[model samples]
Target: MASKVCVFTGSRSDFDRLYWICLEIQKTEGLELQLIAGNMHLSPEYGLTINAIRETGLHVDAEVDMLVSSATSVGTAKTVGLGTLSLAETFNRLQPDIILVLGDRFELLSVASACTCMTIPMAHIGGGQTTEGAMDEQIRHMVTKASHLHFVANEMFGQRLKNMGEEVWRVFITGSPSIDSLMRTPKITTEDLSKELGLDLARPTALVAYHPATLDPLNLEAHTNQFIEALSQFEGQLVLTYPNGDPGSEYIIKSFQKLDAAHGDRSVLIPTLGITRFVSALLHVDFMIGNSSSALIEAPTFNLPAVNVGDRQKGRLASSNVISCAQDSASILRAMQEAMALGKSPCGKPYGDGKASPSIVSALKSTLEKRTRQQLLTKKFSIPGEDK
Candidate 1:
């Protein structure tokens, strides 16, 4: 019998990163792919991205509807509580051999918590990366401690897992699967993408894919206005995406709406653009303006210039393609100038070599063949000086 591997996705962001690995799991012999989508994917407020998953020729084994409609911190806390409740029941019914989850989203904590109580093994992708500016810093580490297997983008991240007591044998330095999706997917022609987006991309354009700094308690509106003001000064067409469903994203959305109303023809605002279209935009746009991980992880592959505003992605690895700036009109405008001048040059790839899917698949297959669930689930605490 094939090893049944279930992948959990909570939002379009993580789904995009997981897309290629899911494809690899499906095609490889002796492996079965199961998918569970919940939270923002089920919420129409976030573009109902579960449809995007289904449209990708992947099957959804289960759907967990657990997001609370409230937009406050308590709402986020409740979403996690509800996710754990629903996923606990889902696990009871599905009985997957192992679970796969990615990134630092709080929803993954819900998935990890359920798997831990059930004694199911988990393989966590994007482990060991840091985002000091957001609550993800804490959630990512929490999931890392719970996961049985680790697939990280770089050696630095791989080592961090070891420091956290994960045996070296369990942590695999398989570059980010996001790179695989970015490089392998066929390009959407600029004209077709422009038509789909209803924007004339033939002219100079910048893409804004920012998300809220979930840890930042103050200046949500002030920080948002700073970036909008800077973008308004840009001499090119602007494409803005709605923030992900984080606590203070409401502020970001309202600010974007005002900018849209003011800028009219010069700006195009979208709720969500699935992976393909988003990557296509990166391929053609002059530069990116945001703190989304894609700016640090995927844009480097395209040699794309990205202006990373504020602290949302403060400590993560970035390449020359990224111009880091403060969340102020003057600082953002200065970085935009630097971004425009860079103009699509070669950027370093700190994430991986754009072929992480096969390595991850091979690791999963090897672990499945050689290790039992009990063996995989057994923990080994490494005292750095003592382990060696």
Candidate 2:
């Protein structure tokens, strides 16, 4: 019988990055794929991304609804607790041989904790990367410590995992699976983009996908207001996507509504653009303005200039195309001006060459074959300077 591999997707963004890996697992023999959908994907306020998953024809083995509607720190903490309780139940029922989790969301961390207690080995992706402006930085590290197998985006990240006492044999540098989607998906045309967004794509346009800085909770509103003020200086159409389901997201959403209302025809606000449409929009937009990881990781794939405002993406690796600035309006405007001045340019491949899914699948297969459940559960701490 094939080994059952359970994949957990908490948000649309995580699903997008993990889609190809799931597809590969489904096609490969001796691997039974079980998908557990939860968190923002189940919430209607977050674009009901579960439907998007269904449309892809992937079977969802279970659905765990644990997101709290409240956007406060206390609410987020409670949601994580609820998610852990619910996931424990789900794992008990599913009894998957291996659980695969991606990224550093609190929900994913909850799942990792449940898996660890359940004695179910987990495979984690996007480990060892830093996001200093948000709590995800710590969550990512915690997940890495819990996971038995690691698939990182780059060698530097893999080294970081090894430095954290993870055995070097278990860490694999698989680049980023999101870049695989960007390379394989066909670009959406200008006519189609213009028709869908109801904006003239002939002129200069900017795609904005900012999320709240979870670390700077007190200054969320102030930072968002400053960002909006900076965006007002731009002359072309501004297309904004809704923020992620983090604490203070409500404040960012309200700011986006106000910007849409104020700009009218000059700005468009979309609750969610999905992944394909988002990548297509990247191809058409003159530049990207936001602190979204996509701006730093995926935008450069299209040679798109991204004006990354605020410290939300503080410690991630970025290309020459990414222009970083403070949260203030004047600094953001200046950064945007600099990005526009660069115009269209070629970007170096700091992420990968768009082939991460296959590598991840291979690593999963090999690791499972090499280690039993008990062996994977028995982890030893490695000192930073210890000889191999």
Candidate 3:
């Protein structure tokens, strides 16, 4: 019998990262692929990416409707609650041998919690990493403890899992599966992107992809406006990608759209771009100004300079090519100026060498065929006289 593995993708961001791993699972004999689409995937506002997955010639085993309609943390929490409730039913029906989840989105946490209750062993990716500005830090670690197999992006993350008392044998340092998309797919050329989007490739360009810091929403508009003001002063073309489905995302999207409409030939705003086009655009651009992790991890491989503004991505890895700045007009502009002048930072290779998918698949096949959960869940206690 094939070992059944169910993967959850709630947003375009996570889907892009998990695409290669899902393909790997599908190709493995005796490994059944189940995709559960929820949250933003169902939302028409964020491109309704479920169809995109189907377009790839893959089957979606289950569809869970769990996006809370409102735009607040309370609404996000409600979405999590609903995801858990719906996923319980889905899992009960599928009875998957393993549940695969990636990253630290609130929706991923709900799936992890539900799987924990059902005693379905979870294989988690991208844990043992930190993004202190967002609440993802808490959700990521919570899922880490509940997981049976961990595929972290780097050695540091694997060590962190060990420090947390997780069995070293259960953790695998597989780097990031996201980079696999770059390796497998053909690179998009500047001419192709320009023709597709009617963007002028000759102009000095700024590619912006930003998201809200869930921890602090008070200065959302203020910070957004500051970045806009700085970008407005630039004498070049600008392309902006909409933010993720967080509380303050709507405001960011509106601001970008407004700027595009007002700035006519100089600026273009897209709600979302496909992976190939996005990565290609990143390569063709002069500088990336945003807090998106793609700027941190993927851009470096292209030798692109990234100006990461604000705290949304507080505690993540960045190459020397990346410049950090506050969410203020002067600070952002200063960083942008530096980014335009600085040379490409050598690829750190800290996140992995784009071989994450195979490593993950090999481990999963071995674990699933074993058909028995390892007794790696031992707890440590302070023994008497252990302290010197």
Q: Give the TM-scores of the predictions, in the order they appear.
A: 0.97, 0.98, 0.95
Error of 3 at 371 (Å): 5.6
* Model 3 vs. true fold: TM: 0.95
Q: What is the lDDT of candidate 2?
A: 0.90
* Each prediction's RMSD to truth: 1.3, 1.0, 2.4
For candidate 1, lDDT tens digit of each residue in 124-207? Answer: 999888898899999999999999999999999998888888898899999998888888878899999899887899988899
For 1-388, candidate 2 gives per-residue lDDT tens digits of 7889999999889898889999999998888999999999999999999999999999999999999989888889988999999999999999999999998888977898798888999999898898999999999999999999999889899898888999878899999998998998777889998998989988889999998799999898888888989888788889999999898999889988988999988889999988878988989989999989999889989999999888889999999899999889999989888988887799776888899999999889878888887888899887668865
Model 2 spans > 4 angstroms off: 384-388
Best by TM-score: 2
Which prediction has the highest lDDT against the true structure?
2
lDDT of each: 0.89, 0.90, 0.83
Better of 2 and 3 by TM-score: 2
Worst lDDT window (10 residues) for model 3? 376-385
lDDT computed for candidate 3:
0.83
| Candidate 3 lDDT tens digits, 1-388 | 8888899889888888888888899889988888888888888888888888888887888889898877688888899899999999999998888888889888987898888788888889998888888888888999988888899988888888887767666789888887887777677778888877778876788788888888878988898899889888877788888888888888888888888888868877887887878878877888888888887888877788999989878888777778999989999988988988874656565677789998998898886776475442333422323542
> After TM-score superposition, what is the CA distance of residue 373 in candidate 1 from its true location, in Å?
1.1
Output the lDDT of residue 249, model 3: 85
